[model samples]
Target: EDQVTQSPEALRLQEGESSSLNCSYTVSGLRGLFWYRQDPGKGPEFLFTLYSAGEEKEKERLKATLTKKESFLHITAPKPEDSATYLCAVQAGGDSGYSTLTFGKGTMLLVSP
Candidate 1:
């Protein structure tokens, strides 16, 4: 079975502090790794999709990197607006010609100004 684990269930950071969130995953065959940011009471917003090892994507203050077994979301100089629940999910290849996502519990980031 595919599985995902996100470290540090919650993180507290100062307004200008920088940090990285880890997403470790295990799958029989990896199709893609996805990153998302979700605010309370709202659905998750798409951040990035990494298809291969060494691939990376960035938007504003967030950067995502993927490896064979894990992915990382790097937040540089965060602000209170950046406080959100960061989610990680993995798509696994299957014989049915479809893919399904297995998600982690997510990391709740709270940035205080």
Candidate 2:
């Protein structure tokens, strides 16, 4: 089984402020880790995919990093439009040649202008 944990269930930041969200996980035979963003009443939008430690990906004001045990999502100079819930999910392989995504609760960020 795979488990994931995210810290600071909610975050409030002023426009232009910078902060980071954390996601820690435990999994067997990890295939990939994924980052996503979701808005109220909407499905999650894909952000990044990290396959190995020391890997990174960026888009707009967001940057994602991965390590052996965890992942971090850094938001730089965010704007009001950036407010959303950030999600972390991991895909792991099982004995039956199947893979499933184990997700964390997510960190909700509110950026104020």
Candidate 3:
């Protein structure tokens, strides 16, 4: 079965604190792994697209990486404004030539000032 699981469910960090979040997945075939940030009352904001194992992408204070079985989002010197729900989604590549996303529950982050 293809599925995604994110750990820690929720995280609390102080301003300037750094941490790494994990996303575990199981799938028959992987097309891509995606990372997103969702703010309250809004849709998820795209963060990164990892095409294969060992590939990584980064933004302001975030970095995302992928492997054969899982992906990771690393936060560096986080700020209060960085607080949000981090989501992990997977695109399954079957014979259809296209794919659909299977999303994880998400990791809610709280950064205290």
lDDT tens digits, residues 1-113, model 3? 67999998999999999999999999778988999999999999999999899998999999998889889999999999999999999998867767999999999999999
> In order, what lDDT does every prediction score?
0.95, 0.95, 0.93
**Per-model TM against the reference:** 0.97, 0.97, 0.96
* Model 1 per-residue lDDT tens digits across residues 50-109: 999999999999999998989999999999999999999999997785898899999999
Better of 2 and 3 by TM-score: 2
Q: What is the lDDT of residue 16 in candidate 3?
A: 97
Better of 2 and 3 by lDDT: 2
Worst 10 residues of 1 by lDDT: 93-102
Q: Clash pairs of candidate 1?
A: none
Q: Candidate 2 on 1-113: residue-level lDDT in tens?
A: 68999988999999999999999999999899999999999999999999999999999999999999999999999999999999999999978878889999999999999
Candidate 2 Cα outliers beyond 4 Å, as residue runs:
none
